[model samples]
Target: MSNSSIYTIQPIEFRLDLKDPFLFTAHHIDHFPAGNTQLGPTVPSTPEKPYQMYYGDVVPGFPEHPHTGFETITLVESGFVDHFDSLGNSGRYAQGDVQWLSTGNGVEHCEMFPLVHQDKENPFELFQIWFNSSPEEKKQDADYKMMWREQIPHVLQTDSNGHQADIRVVSGSFLNTDALSRPPHSWAAAKENRVNIYMIRLEPHAELTIPATTATSTRFAYFYNGPLLYIDGQEIPFKHLVELKPDTEIHLKNSDQVASIMWLEGEPIGAPVAMRGPFVLNSTEELNVAFARYRQTHFGPWPWPTPAPVFPREQERFASYQKGVDVEYPERM
Candidate 1:
């Protein structure tokens, strides 16, 4: 729908087309069956089926891959993810966790979704967003950081009708709650950038108001889950994205069923973007240079034994940074 408050409404596919300052976003929801000895689904995923094994056959995920000139923000809503990168960082993070990786010049990373459970179904859901980096920031060294579920901020609000709205602040401030710190070289590092990513859930028949930001910022609301939703009293269907006016307050009213929405807003980078495969750069010439560099260095050699490494079945949520001390979280019940 086109209006003064909304620019466009588009149906969401596997990969979402985002605007400046944001390159790409995809929502992955896979209902994997029991795992075999290889930690992959007992029933292999086919192209026409609901389950997708993307790049890995033994393990259902992308293997060692290169990325440049962008940052990956992975939010795991349901299941766990095993992350291995060339910088010698590894981690196993689960539901409610967020992994922010700045690829800087270049980095090779493996994201394997291990079906930890062997006896029952293993359902996994995650949202991965590719945020653009400035020309200068793209040349810095790679960095990886994890925001555990405990460290991230979650806020709850209830309207006069007592219907509640649950808000998870992933990259920006919501109400009085602030998100965890981002990588130093991230485009979101600057407060003036006004980069914000929020995951909001509304109870049945709930009403919530999204506060306004600067007019210069770009804003979008994606109605990903649940039934009907009303934005500023306008009906919004499921699996649809609306480009919102950043300077105006927006009201969201959910139907009788619970609803989930992903809200992304940020000031435009206003830089020329040239993308080729996994490389994002300013010009085509720069992308060519990135490709040549990756071929020459292989993004600093993969230290892990296999491109897709499956951690022990009993391993809990933990992070082993390249330089920092390794840390482990309490085992989930």
Candidate 2:
């Protein structure tokens, strides 16, 4: 309840305020109705429900968009995401899967959330994090990788009281578990960067101790879902972000209800950052050049039929890579 491990605590809105090496994080939790003929929400979003259709008229998702100078790590917690990109790659990934897209140089992609189930409610939840790239790496070739749910490591930690904490390692290492390899040009690809993204779910009344990370790394824990959490004996309310001293060990205790937290840690890139819409660059001049180039090239042109494309209802989880062989997962249990 009393410790110097916590630097600050703030409420989280639509996006979590992050530090260097991390540009932005958007948390989407939409309660969509049954699918229409087009597989979109049957009813329009209202002020009360506020089910955002974000650039998608027929679906609740983002249409084809361009990005540069950064990488997008999309973690799907529930529901599914249909992905289409200008590189002639497409995929339909579902719960627990992670998609890492490096828009180096430039790339265009669309992420559509389809209401596949017509008989029941389609509750969608995901976190899309923008990881910043260094100036030199920004000019590298674009790359993409998919870490399926089965490929990702899930570490279970049991406290002395027998309570457990389930941790999903998306990037970087935790305890003895190392995450899958990231893109070659990604800032996280360098071992010295110390970038780590972990999704932790604590059972009711669970207590877990997080070991100290590198002294130079910037770390924060976003408590997105839960009733109550205690950090170092300090009570932390739900939907709050806590900045932690990376060099100090941190203790977490959850209340009676299940609690979930997203922990992000990375060494700062220590570069001038200039962002405009989806483009991120080192300076305003570079940002302008990026826009001009996009207008000229349109990021290799949209290859998909529609800006927001969705797969057939019966199509299972799969990924069609541009330069690699296609992959298909086993049918959902």
Per-prediction TM-score: 0.96, 0.96
Candidate 1 structure, TM-score to reference: 0.96
Q: Compose the digit string of candidate 2's lDDT tens values, residues 46-72.
A: 776657788888888899999999999
Residue 4 error, candidate 2, Å: 1.4
Q: Which candidate leads in lDDT?
A: 1
Q: What lDDT score is found at residue 86 in candidate 1?
A: 95
Worst 10 contiguous positions by lDDT, candidate 2: 324-333
Candidate 1, 1-333: lDDT as tens digits: 545788888898778888989987999999888888778889866664468888996889999999999999999999889999999999999999999999999999999999999999888999999999999999999999999988888899999999999999998788788888999999998878989899999999999999999998989999999979999888899999999999999999999999999999999899999998888999999998889888899989898899888798888898888633655564432
Q: Candidate 2: which pairs clash? A: 1-232, 1-233, 1-234
Q: Report lDDT (Cα) of residue 45, candidate 2.
A: 66
The per-model lDDT (C-alpha) reads: 0.90, 0.89
